[model samples]
Target: MKLDALGMAQSTLVFVVLGLTLLAFMWGRFRYDLVALAALLGSVMLGLVPAEAAFNGFGHPAVITVVAVLVLSRGFERAGVVDLIADQVLKVGERLLLQLTVLVGTVVVLSGVMNNVGALALLLPVAMRLSREHNTSPSLLLMPLAFGSLLGGLTTLIGTPPNIIISSYRGDVVGENFSMFSFFPVGASVALAGLLFIVLVGWRLTPHRAGQATAEDMFDTANYLVELRVDEEAKAKGLTLQQLQDELDETIPVLAVVRDDKRSAGYAFYDALQEGDILLLEAGPDELKVLEDKVGLSVVVTPEEDDDSSTIEKQPEHKKDGNNKDDDDSPARQVDTEGLQLVEAVVRTDSMMVNRSVRQLRLHHQFGLHLVAVARDGARLKQRLRDIRFQGGDVLLFQGGENEISESLATLGCLPLAKRELNLGQPRKLFFSMAIFALAIIAMLLDILPTAVALSTAALVSLLVGVLPLREAYQAIDGPVIVLLGTMIPVGQALETSGGAALIADTLLHFGSKWPIVMTLTGLFILSMVLSNVVNNAAAAVLMAPIAASLAEGFDASLDPFLMVVAVSASCAFLTPIGHQSNTLVLGPGGYRFGDFWKLGLPLSMVVMVVAIPMILWVWPL
Candidate 1:
């Protein structure tokens, strides 16, 4: 095959862009999304990819399917499906191996139908809790759970983005796409083997880090000392301090009591409760919120109230003042606290709020956030929370809408602490979420609709029915992953159009002609696995699918084995945190360093290759 000058130039440009992308991805200096976008722009500028088609990847079916799957995952999470399952699983005893089997296996199964990252997210808190209860390091459970989620994606077409991309490429080449369960035989075989390995041996290889710390300790909530006032309508008004403590489940301790400005220090257990009495309490933000809701107590306003209101209590009246001035006939819009959350954030040295007080920042008036508590190390804050100046290391607990809280935290340069599972545990819309997801899966398996359309429709229905709020639904979709996919798709096409993929395949066949076909398949699998670890799996699949097809055609063999190899290998990105989103998701929570993944991942990857090669050959017959 003679290469034309234009073809050679295009191929060279494509390879150059791909090489730089790989370097950028490995360097970790820039985010993957930025790297991909720069590569796409480079391709367009070099005339390797058309400018008009540069952004077409964002609208691709694979991208759409991923987005839909994310939205659906959020729906399942918000509906408390994982909590419902955790309750049942927690009853099965605390045996480490058995717990590992069940928790890892559940995430694997869940990954077959939903996004793997979402599956990991749902089970992560459960795994942490189990770790605490069983007195085990989370490192033993987290890596296994992350690997299980990746392996589970191998079983179904929509289980992971790479599978969907490979299936779509197959449709373009062979005129018929693989079915939803087309990957089941080989995928399930590999996933089950990997799961067993993790259950039996892989976790044993994990590094033992400090993983038994409770969420409170992880967030450093020991210094939070807040005061609440007993309201006239409060149930605690008539109860003694000890009775109030007992009613609160004894989780929080009442430190002191101030009645009519006379302070009674040290465990006011025998003090009688009275209206307008201030109770100094030692509790975290979550406990404080729960106490307020249960007893109808209000946060005590600080004595040094500046001209500006400095407490949550005064904000409503302050807003009402505006309403009264604007129109006496107009009713004020009440703040919606239905889905409000209590989040802990620590002010960074570079934070905009580093030297500002809550009163100076006007957090509540400007951002709908009310400062509930603030904790500073080495010294107890005795003044009003709003008047307390926030230093670099100050941890502040803010209460507001979940979305607003997240945005405010970012805007103020504060890092959120460990996320708390604050679900009502009722699974309010569990049946609705499950039914919709089931219908979508059934429709895909039955070929009633395209995979993208079915999942997208289910996502839309989930939003319309309020299974997940609109804001959360949008947040569910990972923006960087989408951009990486959208940008890389066109680049993959450019490689194929320039005959670069064919050249790579011809080189592989040239060398593999003397070897067995299984060796060739194994080579492809290993190469894809390496690429997946170094870059995004979707990008690996997109780049390798054409090469796999070309090799099959060159050798005059079946395409099934080649594509199957690509699918299995692409999902086996266990070598690095950046290789797969699931791994990255667990890195911080699992207390894993960058080098920590390979402790167990290297062995697991070998296991995948050993188990997957024969399974693919037997199932698809090269």
Candidate 2:
């Protein structure tokens, strides 16, 4: 293999891009997708890939493959396939561990046959609902469920992006194909073991900080105290405050009363309400508005101008004014004219500030959000100011200006916490949707249909059969990932075509020729794992697959073991969220520290390697 100066320059550019992306990931400068696009733009500037091929990855079969998988997953979701499973499996009366096991098991089983991230998306909301109902921290369940999804993807070729990339590379390397279940035994073993760990003690070990609060806590309604008018025609116009309370369930209290410009400070409970009398009450904004409407009353404009005041009354005529404007300066939008307001956000596990105190993140200095109270389960932090290490699922009660809440949460990889209150509006064509997907996978595995053809067919069927809206089915696929994957495929092909992989392989093998085949495979696995964490896993697979095959050739070993090693190792994205999509999704939800992964993931990766090696050797034999 030979490389001209241009080729070397291109390779150098690629390496530089990889280095910068790693630094950006560590620095939290931008999204991983954005970083990759930036690197691609850099490659074009350096003329690494010709202008024509710059956008080639967008059209690649692999890119199409990922999109098709996403659409298919959505089809299944719309068909109520996952919801059906949940209906039967997510029983409320089950033991905690049993419930987790059933939920995690279903997620794993489903993910093993589909995109793991897609599987997680379907189950996440269900888990949130379960957590609320069980009065437990979602944090305790989400991490284990997420890890289960990752493990489950190991079972099938199309389950995760890396596996598909590895199998495609196998065709390029040894002129062989990976069967749908070629790696199933080994992958399934590891998945089962990992799932057990998650069910038995993993969820239990997590901090159950989410105390007793319901999902409603995440959307804290603003409280307001206002006085209302009693119109002549209103039902409560001549009723006493105590009489009105008796009729309307008495949840609201009439705090004060005023009539004929005279104020009464004593409890207004027994005071009679006249047409012009004022009744002061405390309630949330929505509640107050509803009460005003129901009572045919107008809001008191000022503290002194109660219902009894002789002033311009009745609902004011609609007019264009600064008050009606939606801009930040508008008083209507002002929760805190003092520049402080309350908000709620979920803590992500991978946040750099996770496991750190509010003082450590310097909440006010860095993000301008003051920690008001931290809620876990339904329980509020007893000592909010002094003791609290943010963990995943701990909902923070925040005091900050509008939009600062979102900005601050983004920095922590957290999100404005949301709960799934399902209103199953309609049931789509479930049977047809499931039939199409099942047939597609079967056809692909039977060699009667190519995977791309099968999946694309399934996606189309979903639209035609009314399982997914035509607009929405297409919308489910990520455009940037499609572009990145499609564009990079040809570049990777050019690398292999030019013997760049062979050249790299020769150098590695030359230095370790005396090493046994197992050791050689292990070395390649380690290299693949490291590269996948820093760069895109699919890109890492493209770069390393051919090298792994070349190494097998040098050692006179079966290419199957080497290919499987590349597949498994590339998917073991344990070190960083940037390594995998599932990891990134959990970053904000788990409230995990960036450094926290290596604690659990590093050990899991080792277990995968140790378990996979023997299985690969036994099943595929070197």
Candidate 3:
């Protein structure tokens, strides 16, 4: 491709726009979709990209395939695939090495057939339980699991967004996309090598993280749990458990009811409260005061909370300032403590609670649940309950009815870190999920349908057959991710069509061509891997694939090996938490600091690069 004066000017403009787009991505201040859109609009305005093609990327095969894969990943979850497989992991016993192997291996296999992040989401809590059970730091297991998901993504087309995007670019190049299992030969080899290193050696390289010393520290019940006596004139006297929450502008969970000297809580939310009914509440001193004055409830002091070390010991003395001393002097209340379940759950990347405060969740009003304590990065949050904003991977301690806890966690988009707490899934849906997935693979293998068409049709069949509800299917589609892909595709084309990629290729070859071809390939892999650590992997692939193709031409080498190198290396985002969602998902729960990933990830990256270059050359044959 030749460039005249105007075309050269346009190439410079594309370079400027892409530089700024990359900065914005690494800055982490703005959402990626917004950044990608800005880049596309800039390219069009600068005459680097045609204005007519601005919206065409939305209808691209890559965008559709990403959407369909997301929905299908959710369908598999709703069908108990993870639950069924997770039950098997618990049987791995307490041997740390054996546990790590099975844990990383399970996520690896699951990642090959489903979205890598989705597969990680299903297994993360299981990994947490293993950490808790073995009495080891979550840091040991989490980072490897995150890295394993990235490795597993290399094994299949739909495993990660980057693979799908790479395949689309390949389709545009040769008029045919890579086959469904084309990645398996190279990807599986790299994955198995990476998985073994993580299980056997890399896990020991993780930073020492010390927090949440025991499971008891997970639930904050010392001062928060209390007994409230309802009077005849109380606002809660006539209302059912849920109704009381509905009426209050500021509500606290009524943990249980004490009636006629005995406690009864079954159907508590549906039953109406009566006079003299004592309600067990999870509230702070401020909320307790609000209930005492506004709801006409009285606090009953129990014999030193449930624990001797409880900070609630001084609560009775603090409230002894006078008028209500008679109630304080009454015999210590015998509170019934049955059927209440306190469970720990992690906030997921897709959770609605992300960036939302406890006051905003309205969990009690909606799900009859109480937020007892929250731990992030392996330590309990010290901020006020309402001031605490949630982030992905934050561990939360919730107190609710035994049966209601499971439903509430699913509704709140949090995964319980407890054992065998997978969603209540039907066996029939499990069959449906697996069967539909197999059929999609068959369709692609036989070339009866294209990868995008086959997977989209399978996703549609899952919805029609009720593998997942219609509402959930819609929720499964990540709008921001889809938008980022659709908008960035055209901007990426502007980089190629505008001669910007040719300019970059010339600069790269000028300095890099003195080395052997293997050295050049190694540099490309290293550059792509480093770029992936700083930005979204899909975006890295989007920006690099064109430059990669251009570089292959400059070297007079076949494009398959170069493309394969880009595909595999772009998913090697092991050096940082922000590199991928799977890494981000393990951030808070693993108690890792910003600088922590490189400890394990640096060696792991070198391993992947060493193993991957030879594998790619041998398999794809440059």
Root mean square deviation (Cα) for candidate 1: 13.4
User: Where is the poorest 10-residue window by lDDT in model 1?
Assistant: 329-338
Q: Among all windows of ten consecutive residues in candidate 3, which has the lowest summed lDDT?
A: 317-326
Task: State the lDDT at 565 in candidate 3.
Answer: 88
Winner on lDDT between 1 and 3 is 3
Cα lDDT tens digits, model 1, 76-125, are 87888776766666666778899899998999988987788778766776
lDDT of 1 at 288: 61
Clash count, candidate 1: 0
Model 1 reaches what TM-score against the true structure?
0.71
Q: Give residue 519's error in model 3 in angstroms.
A: 2.4
Q: How well is each residue in 1-622 modelled by candidate 3, as lDDT tens digits?
A: 5454466677877878988998998887666778888888877777777889898998999899999999999998888888888889978988878988998999999999889988898888788777777787778888888998999999999988888888899999979888888889889998998988988888889875764434554443433456777887888788877666556655465666778877765234466889988787666566766777677787764554453424344564333321233343332223344466767788876577887887787777677677767887767665556778788778887777777888788777787776656665888898889999999999999999998899999999999999988888887787768888888899889889888888888888998978888888888899899999987899889888998999999999988888888899899999988888889888877878778898888888898889888988898887
Off by over 4 Å in 1: 1-8, 215-428
lDDT of 2 by residue, 133-243 (tens): 777666667667777788888898778877777777776566666867887998898888777777775665554444423433332221223456677777788776546
Full-model lDDT for every candidate: 0.75, 0.65, 0.80
Ranked candidates (lDDT, high to low): 3, 1, 2
Model 2 CA deviation exceeding 4 Å by range = 1-14, 21-28, 44-47, 92-94, 204-428, 494-500
* Candidate achieving the largest lDDT: 3
